[model samples]
Target: MANSAPASVWRNPIHFLAFGLGSGAVPKAPGTFGTLAAVPFFLLLQNLSDVQYAIMLVVTSLVGIYLCGKTSKDLGVHDHSGIVWDEFVGYWITMWMAPAGWFYIVLGFVLFRLFDILKPWPISWIDKNVHGGFGIMLDDILAGLMSFVVLQALVRFVF
Candidate 1:
């Protein structure tokens, strides 16, 4: 199926990034596609020192607020399914300093997606009650943080 976004929307760099390099435009499972698009970024940052990695996540999250907010307004949709920059940053957050190799990456991906889609507790509350760019980013941020906690625990205790 064709992308639901307007033609002019792609002209804006913010919208493009917010769409996860067009992966978000996918007709099905855009969030999954966006999360997949994030894998490369996670790999690139894999070797950085913890401080540097943290800085990168902070920068991306800050920028994602504007990106997602603007794109949502432009599309006249709140938290549109195609707006997946949140997924990109969320996946990165979930994978931060995760174990090396494909297994860990896949595990991180699954965990992140699970929390993101499920939107438990604070995530659900934020998704329902918050507004604007920060709101769009907040739920996914919590989901990422939650996934990180679970992944870390599993790595430490189960695996």
Candidate 2:
């Protein structure tokens, strides 16, 4: 798939993020790689105050809409599996306000992946119905929100 991707796919800056800094080009489980690629960024963001983190999240998500949309149009594929920026954003959302520690990171990762893959209820609904850049982002956004709720609960009540 990477080999077949258009040259512009690599040349375009937006594609870099949409492709998860080339992690999305990985042949297997690109979404997982994308999520993993997000870890360092998450660590960086973790140091910020909650307000700063929230602002960055909003910026990333807003840019992601255009980045993913343009890349999908360039690739002639809507929400291509190779486009994993959504995963990066989604995982970050899942980790929002999560407790500090590698344990929480792993927990967030696992839970986010489950919700993303399973696409339960509204997530599934949005995936099937939405279109364009917004469509590309909405499902993962929902998954992240759902995962955030669960992770916060576990952090507060169980751990």
- Give the range where candidate 1 is weakest over 10 consecutive residues by summed lDDT: 1-10
Candidate 2 lDDT tens digits, 21-136: 88887777888888999999999888888898889889989999999999988888888887889999999999988889999999999999999999999999999899888998
How many residue-pair clashes does candidate 1 contain?
Answer: 0
Angstrom error of the Cα, residue 33, model 1: value is 0.4
**Cα RMSD for predicted model 1:** 1.9
Displacement of residue 44 (Cα, Å) in model 1 is 0.7
lDDT of 1 by residue, 20-95 (tens): 8888987789899999999998888999998898999999999999998998887788898888999988988898
Task: Give Cα-based local distance difference scores for all models.
Answer: 0.88, 0.88
List clashing residue pairs in candidate 2.
none
Q: Once superposed on the true structure, which residue ranges of model 1 sit more than 4 Å away at CA?
A: 1-3
